[model samples]
Target: MNIGKTLFAQVMEFVPWKTFGRIIERHQGDAGVRTLGCADVFRVLAFAQLTWRESLRDIEACLAANQTKLFHMGIKAVPARSTLADALTQRDWRIYHALAQRLIARARALYAQEPSDLGLDATVYALDSTTIDLCLSLFDWAPFRSTKAAIKLHTLLDLRGAIPAFIHISDGKLHDVNVLDVLPVEAGAFYVMDRGYVDFARLYALHQAGAFFITRAKKGMDARRVYSAATDRSTGVICDQSIRFNGFYASRDYPEHLRRIRFKDPESGRTLIFLTNNTSLPALTIAALYKSRWQVELFFKWIKQHLRIKRFLGTSENAVKTQIWCAIATYVLIAIIKQELHLDASLYTCLQILSVSVFEKTQLSCALQPDRTQPELVSIANQLNLFEI
Candidate 1:
């Protein structure tokens, strides 16, 4: 009988440890270490995320339980809760942040060839944010309101392969629209956002930078129509028109003509008013681009459910940021593995499989293979609603 490294070790093989070292050196992450080094800290945190460990004590208990295999897993010693807590609250979170960016670049390169069904070959992105609530007593500094504390995760997700191109962590008190000022706008790319991000000045900045934006129009928006374009009502497009802002600030912020479309959802029967800077694309295509914005919402839901972002390991700001960044890294690592191995299973399914088999001694790809011995029939009823009472 032959025993090998655990699935967790195999999965971590994709990380560029050498480049990771340069980031650590730049941050002085491991200026001095006696027992628990930065790598060990990362291994523990990544393990906690992958296995759904809820608290610091839970992580310590699990690592202690597997103490004999700690060296094999590249851990020098099992850290006590206090030691791990100190590391989480003191270590520079930029190491993991830079690492996540590196992984995002690799994932983007791998997904560069992915086809976009939105009828264009340009880079399309969805901008959105999710609020993670925290206990006011435990995290007083994150003050969302007089009674509540929380943090906001602003993410810009590329539609291709549902990959995150940018991520920013901010206080809950900060408005979503403010994130636009910091965004590195790429020329000729289209950004799809919700109504919460409507700021004429920022939108004008994007326009001046040669980028495009699509967002829902705010209620009572003052605009004067210049020309009306023909639209196909059969495709739910009510009307399309070229218009310019009439309000003093609105006009001064954006001096260019904008396009507005009135659309009605055939299924929901809900009417939607869309605003954009691009005038050439078909009305339906603009509507379709906005519809893709929901992908970022799905991505948020996925990470919150599968990863350990809700139940934090520590209460300090640095600890919270570090854990969240590690969670992002783990997510990107899985994406890289899925693409590199060409696994046919969905990402959620792959995460579920790896969760239970983290310690299994087998190649990650081999472990992910379809079982030939038992050909279980997938119920067609799940795919189709056979009957509704």
Candidate 2:
């Protein structure tokens, strides 16, 4: 099978560079490099991922080989490494953040259309964060521990499509709860989070906003008696009591009507508690939903392992954010192609095809072409007899 001419070329065609070009053009201002518009920067960013270019010099070399593709992506001229680096450092960070938000919105819309096909419910979103370790001495102000220097990437992923709906980056020392404020939680959406994000006030706000959440509660929390003893069938734990606040609780910043569930983890055999405003579902259902929170961990593994996020070329926070966003953007692009081509392949398999097809001198567009009708993905799956039901 001619992998290069089929899969790789097809994937490249799916990148929505036209939409990105428009976003960049609309946001470019009197930021000095007006000639170097958003499209140029975006093209450089996409190419960096597509080629696995180490630095600006490497980007220039890749562009030199395919100047036409750059032009197609809206670059008037290729800027030097130093010039690009200066622009990235001095240019307004808001512009890039806004672009990321736009891309995220687009991804959300695309995923929302066919949730069932992607194995997701409308309300389920997986929330988690991963640490991107860095060189502590250089990025000293960013903070670091004795053994590892890192930054945290907190993401709200729409599990239906494995697309990131909200993302934020912070110093490694920042608590996970601190990043919760920026998440985009729609009314009636179900948010699944781990113990690190166990904040009463935030969960309260979510409840007040008419949103539902399922999270593992901290071990030791104080609550008054509303119900004497109710057995939680899932973990076989008896609920001690439920409480309602007369006024707002300052410690948790919770409103008057928050419901707390006290339970235990069956697998770990440890006492586990959960706090939620959702009363419609039984406690067992809530426990089951929280168990599915492991999907976000799988996402972290997918990106770090498949996309090669561990080998970062930039040490600056902005540079790191840019790289991570690019990787996500690439993942989204491949997902779109997989759906469009009607390929019943797992995302990991698609990513492997993408990695080799793009970086191994094989074009992404060709590899993903429908007309070729190779069915390499199905053949491999059938040979392994991978379970797809």
Candidate 3:
């Protein structure tokens, strides 16, 4: 961040605009138009997300009121509600998706060395999805039920630093299990999911890829125990066994042996059955990995509460995806800032400060800190003054 720039402009300085330009060129996002180019559209939508603007009209009115600061935010001009709406519908959503992924790569690297509670050295991820309800009449493209419509955000989150590594948006009719088919399998990584993704064939695929998985077993599963391993009862682990599927499909899909662990929670006294293929890790550690999957649920709740993905600005599919990806981009950008600046404030606090002080001409990093004392500015010969005397 530098002097003589709006806080919003300073916040956006972390983005790699040169890479963004290449992505725009590859996708032809700026083709045949000049007013709201790809970058400008992203900036305006990001502005809406950061400022909590609900509609295109609200964004238009706000930008109109703050006309002089639009240039600082990389918006060439104030777009009418209609133009912004059309731009949202017209621009390729993949452009924004690619940009979000680019930011994810950087964020993952920044948090790679983050410590894990499980004390495992291998990378671990949690998979889950959350549904957002919509109106059937307005969003006819996404048909969910007879009276209403909905969409799902299938996410794979890196537990380290709670960064989303992958996101897929689909209609509500899609089953949770289907997301596994398109998931990028990484060797030596551990994926923690729930029973909804317990297709034997798919789990076998992960096993063959040299990756590990921890998932809850369905009640009354059709598997026969081949061998039982020793377990310490005081640790809550009731039994650890090597099992083989008895059903025809399960047997055919996975001919190899599987490890199953039954553990009882001390407080609830309820037992849980967990299935996995990795035999090297301790049974308690595997159970703890399953327990950590709740982090993904917390992540979904966090984004839904803080971001603008719930009420959409456009009804078209492209428009919906655009809004979602921009929200994700804003999220990763904030995470990057938090890590780089070493700020003590929580994300919620940082967002609250940024939301109100976006256009404030002050030191952004200092203002976002938990301690908000103003810092003295030093003159820089290369920097031009906002107003020359």
Candidate 4:
């Protein structure tokens, strides 16, 4: 409950910063002026997450003032703006990519547990993407932002744990369906996707892998019934339907795998169409499962609002990728802390706590050695009237 216990500090202690430093050293591979080590670069990235500082100068200034605190966090010295900027601009992005993948894999290992016994026939994952607008004049080559600037962050989120399992970044012009091949999918896992990702070939690939999926049929697609629908007594929703696609049904080889789930929208008094390969479950159950995909949208909202990710400090493609990945890394750290604390706080609330407890203090001593404990945190929460415990 002592949320003031610098979440970033606590979580960073767990990450192998030294190993990352070694990675950077190795990447340098018999180089010149030494430059900044990986720890220093990570410090800057971590600082960006702890505070929404957008520029290298701001980070340098903050670190310079809090040198002792930075030292505690494993930063040897505050690198100059020029140095940090050059390091970011020149450093091989593949190193960062490898580092990120390693971090995610480690987190998954730390948090993995037996699948929840929800008695559901399948586990569900959701897929979606959000646009991170950039400066068109600055990052000119970025795709889909010919008039304006933007990048797409496509993610596959595990619905049960509200955790992102896989993430990919592409130019703004990239279609959601095109990124499907890059994501990791398990055989029994169910994927719920928005209309933007409706591609017959990709869906068929998932079907071929023995995975299940539910998606809204595009408006113009034709549907032919294979079985009469049974009505649900409580919700008045249709129970089941066998359907044939207007086009060559990609999954035609697996005829028994296709089913239609129909439900009336409570708000509009209109019927919603959902196509799925899962036939063992009832129609309403499929609808309910697909409905959970909205959680990914909420996750996007949380990141955009809480992480201050709308603005970009770097102009080039690499800089944009670095900033976005750092933001995600930050989010993962916060989520890990929330799990460690056994607190049911929302991500924004947790970030707010971290911002106040870590970044607001001018001195590292004040920030790290705050005389706050679980009781004090509870009291502060009560005084601040934060009911999101």
Candidate 5:
């Protein structure tokens, strides 16, 4: 199947085009006649993200230069900059959102076997959000400050393979803690977070839904230690205790005892207090799970550096959302490819290879994977290790 096919074409084989077509139909993405439909726009935007195209003109120029390979790449024709911009502005962004959700489901199934590295059997999720600043003039819809505008990406990251389980886009004014109101709670799963999301009311909501949470407790939180649990001091776990809120409002909000872990980081020598509803796991594992929340932070940093979300191809709310969804779909797609192909190469390497070799008429495996029949060059002991976790 890889014979005589471009790497880009083969990479796209993972996409469920028929399903996306249904999504487009449901959204009526092509209700009106146009030079560029929603699907075409997605392909172009995905291509731009993969190839690191800086602007609309850059995308148009690149496609124009490779005009002959358009069909093979699934693009019927090269789109003019104006036409593409119009599509981005008019087409429903929900089409791409649905597509991205489908890709996420498929990717999650493929990566279900991945370990969380916590050595715990329960499902662990890292909850966080990152803000992307925008110019107030260009993005009047998203208001961050008196003069600045921005958008926030609220993400729930499944630590296994770092696949995003849930994503919500909102104006920068939206508080991170507010995301808990819309967060889908799965029973018995562990949700880790920082103190910014430490609202006792929302935490109780999660508790009521039969979900567990591990988050840093805010300073000056009034709580009475009801029972002190035994702990090993050498593991950096200072003390593990069962605590109940001492404040009237806090007690009313969470009318239940919570497990509290006090840990001192041997490396940083910083004492930390962690709050969680899960009482089964060891205090060390709880601390380690909190430490793993950094993966979501790294996930944010990685996509911002590699994807096109930092810069806007269009100014409309719909356009920006569509672009971000497509970028998410692209990231999930590449993650799917990496798993299916079983390539030892990192994602950064895979993207680097595809950036320049997308149009080449070669087998995807041969192009992405090193030749087994030939002698291979030795990899250095220390390489450019980027985002391995």
Candidate 6:
């Protein structure tokens, strides 16, 4: 019998530790560090995310339980609770952020060949934000309200594989629309967002950058129909027209003709008013593009439920950012593993199986494979006879 490393150790094989070490050196992440290094820090936090460990004590205990396997997992030593806590407080979080971006690029390349679900050949992305609430007493640095504190995770998710193409972490006070101003827009890409990001100025900026945007029109939006476009009611499209904003500020902000489509969702029976800058696509296609925005929401829900970002182990801002970035890195690593192995299992299922089996010796692919060798039942005897009744 082959006695191998834990399943968590197997997953860590996908991480480019040497490249990460180089990044740490470049950023001076481990300057004068005696016991705990940057790689060890990330490993501990990443272990917490994968195993759903709640506190520093939990992480220490788990690692201590598996102390003999630490070296196999690329951790030179099992760090104490205080040592790990100090590393989280002081280590440069940018190292993990850079690592996450690098992994994201790889994941994007792998999924780029996938056909768009919306049937469009262009690049499609869903833009949204999820606010993580924090306790104001412990986290006074992140001020959201008078009594509560929080941070917003602004993300741009590629619709192809539901992979995050971009992520921006900001204090909770930042508005969702403002996040658009800092995003580096790719020309010819279609960005689908909710009504919360319906700022004509930002949308116009996106248009000026040669990108298209799809968002829900606000309830009190004032617009004048410039041209009535043809539409089909069979697909739930009520009206398709080219319109210009009528409000003084709105007109000044976005002086271009915006395409408007009113549609009734066949699934929800709710009318949706869609606003977009691209006038070429079919009216039904525009509505479908907006519907794809829900993928980002699902991404948020999945991470929060599976990863340990919601209930933080540390109260410091640095620790919070470190954990969140590590969580994202773990997510990207899983994505890479899934794509590289071409596994058919859902990401949640893969995570759940890997959490406890990290110490198993089975190959990841073999473990994830469906059991197809089960013997088929030859025949079953009828327990109930209709004639007997």
TM-score winner between 1 and 3, please give it. Answer: 3
Query: Candidate 1 — which residues are off by over 4 angstroms?
Result: 1-3, 372-389
For candidate 5, lDDT tens digit of each residue in 132-202?
Answer: 99999999999999999999999999888889999999999999999999999999889999999999999
Query: Residue by residue across 1-389, what tens digits does model 4's lDDT show?
Result: 23333445555765666666676677872156486754556557767777777677777887788776665555678888878777666666555665666676665554555264344745678899999776677777775744886788898877655777788888788888898788787999889997777777777788888898889877876657778667764684744677765445644533444677667867577778888877777776777777788999998887887774677656667766666766776677666655555555666666665665563323323333345456644345436545756
**Candidate number of the best lDDT:** 3
Worst 10 residues of 4 by lDDT: 359-368
TM-score of 6: 0.94
lDDT of 5: 0.91
Q: After superposition, how far is residue 47 of candidate 1 from its true place, in Å?
A: 0.6
lDDT of 6 by residue, 32-94 (tens): 989888888888888888888999899888888988888877788768888888888988889
Quote the lDDT for 43 in model 2.
53
Q: What TM-score would candidate 1 get against the native?
A: 0.94
TM-score of 3: 0.94
Per-residue CA lDDT of model 2 for 239-311, tens digit only, reads 7445664434534477455556666776787666766677766666666677778888988887777674676
Which ten-residue region of model 1 has the weakest summed lDDT?
A: 380-389
Q: Which stretches of candidate 6 lie over 4 Å from their true place?
A: 1-3, 370-372, 376-389
For the record, the alpha-carbon RMSD of candidate 4 to the native fold, in angstroms, is 6.9
- Cα RMSD of all models vs. native, in order, equals 6.3, 7.5, 8.1, 6.9, 7.0, 3.3
**Model 1 global lDDT (CA atoms, 0 to 1):** 0.89
Regions of model 2 farther than 4 Å from truth:
1-19, 29-31, 34-37, 55-80, 91-93, 113-122, 145-149, 228-241, 245-252, 255-257, 262-271, 359-366, 369-389
How far in Å is the alpha carbon of 335 misplaced in model 6?
1.0
Provide the TM-score for each candidate, comma-separated: 0.94, 0.76, 0.94, 0.83, 0.94, 0.94
